[model samples]
Target: MNAYTLLPFIVLIAAMFLMTRSAKKKQQQAANMRNEMQPGSGVRTIGGMYATVKEVNEDTVLLDAGPGVDLLFAKNAIGAVLTDEEYNRIVHGIEHDLKSDAGLVPDDASSLTESDESDGSAAATADDKIDLGKKDSAEHGADAIQAAEDKAAAAEAKAEDESKKTDGDSDAK
Candidate 1:
């Protein structure tokens, strides 16, 4: 066999080895995490159910889903072991000592919009601008509905005229 043919096989074997190695490492980590689960520890199952670990057996776990709700789950079914803060925030709706959001970035692009001082020229000519199918709002709500109805009526009338013209042309032909 040529070296070129062996190269592909070598690459395939290397890839499979690396993938299996990582998968084994992940399994080991999961096993360690599952073994570390103690009573009162918060856990999320593979099915996305959040609960508190009430008991840890050899291959099974007793989870306290809620008050008077004990659910038995396999150790492999536990997806994540959550921190107290995360568990409390999700389950009990308790917020930890969070810093003020003033320093954080805004969630939307509203802050990026041009301010009045940046572009007042557009605002000055806004009233004189022709409509470009922009919906009216606030005080123009009724006017917007009326405009929409008028526009639809005009479209229907135009379609009727076109149909009439087409029929007349057909007769001529």
Candidate 2:
């Protein structure tokens, strides 16, 4: 076989090798992080709960979920060990989104009720009518078609009378 015939197999082997290498690197990092866990450290669980590490066992961890509440979790369940600043920012909401909150619009519908005036009368006085933007015609033009229908009916009646007169005279001619 030509060299090109083996190119696809080589590419497949290289891709699999790279993927496994990266996965092993991540596993090593996670193991190192888990082994370095100590009491009083902040940790996020795989379940997304943030807590302080109360105790670190060989195969398990004790997390302080809240005041007077400690929960036991597997070592693998600890997703990440956060820094003191990031932990306080996330768990206690300290220094979190304060600047963004100043310019943010309210989540509730209370802002929609406000208008130019502050006495609560501006909303009602703004526009009482819902205008369709159509001007009224002097003559509505609806009767334009009605008049044609009436004229057609009148001509039909006259033609029926003319047919009665023509029937008797046609045989005589």
Give me the overall lDDT of model 1: 0.89
What's the distance in Å from true for residue 170, model 1? Answer: 42
Segments in model 1 whose C-alpha atoms lie over 4 Å from true places: 101-173
What tens-digit string does per-residue lDDT give for candidate 1 at 73-158?
99999999999999999999887766855566788854555366756755565557677887668878999889899999999999
Task: List, residue by residue over 17-108, the lDDT tens digit for candidate 2.
Answer: 99999999999999999999999999999999999999999899999999999999999999999988899999997766577778877898
- Model 1 alpha-carbon miss at residue 145, Å: 30
What is the model-wide C-alpha lDDT for candidate 2? Answer: 0.89
**For every model shown, what is its TM-score relative to the native structure?**
0.57, 0.55
Error of 1 at 17 (Å): 0.4
Show the colliding residue pairs in model 1: none
